[model samples]
Target: MASVDLATSYAALILADDGIEITADKILALTEAASVEVEPIWASLLAKALEGKDVKELLSNIGSGGGGAPAAAASAAGGAAAAAAEAPKEEEKKKEEEKEESDEDMGFGLFD
Candidate 1:
């Protein structure tokens, strides 16, 4: 698809999720004026949606009628999933270390 179409599709998804309901023509015009690539714009919108919402919401917003290169969407999803998964692992490791420290302190009867 043309860059304009991709931009419009991305904008439509964003607007729908935000309840803005803007026209595709407006989106095309804005993207053309900004000269930014459609993939980046779509990625940004997806990121924003993910911030205050769940993955299901984000997927529903962008799953249908959203237009961008398929490869871009796939890569973006993969990257986001990897990052989200890693975040929990890191948090768990930190919690484990904290727990160990707490156990050591209790063993010393520091609180008593």
Candidate 2:
């Protein structure tokens, strides 16, 4: 079985909703069939859904397995992708810092 990344699956659903009516059961089944962890993706989707009026109720509905509006889900997926991209920058920065420390320990500077 081909494995689907949860984020990608959620994003796909968000896009699909643009042309068709998406239901909670369909979303749940997609996530489950993907054979990957989807809790984080679901949480992100829920956050987007709650951005409107009655956050508590909105979130409660989402938590109870209700599908969010297409636009909201798409927005959430975009946000998650942006956030995921930042993670690489952080890792790169950490690596650079470690390299600089190692160089310093060796008494080597760019000028040296």
Task: Put down candidate 2 lDDT per residue, 10-112, tens digits, no spaces.
Answer: 6445635454334444455556665554554554554354334453344358755533454455577897766765787899999999999999999889889
Q: Once superposed on the true structure, which residue ranges of model 2 sit more than 4 Å away at CA?
A: 1-76
Per-candidate TM equals: 0.28, 0.31
Best candidate, TM-score: 2
Where is model 2 poorest over a 10-residue stretch in terms of lDDT? 50-59
What's model 2's TM-score?
Answer: 0.31
Question: Model 1 residue 67 lDDT?
Answer: 44
Q: How many residue-pair clashes does candidate 2 contain?
A: 0
The local distance difference test score of model 1 is 0.59
How much lDDT does each candidate structure score? 0.59, 0.56
Task: Evaluate residue 64 in candidate 1 and report its C-alpha lDDT on the 0 to 100 scale.
Answer: 58
Q: How does candidate 1 fare on TM-score?
A: 0.28
| Separate clash counts for every candidate | 0, 0
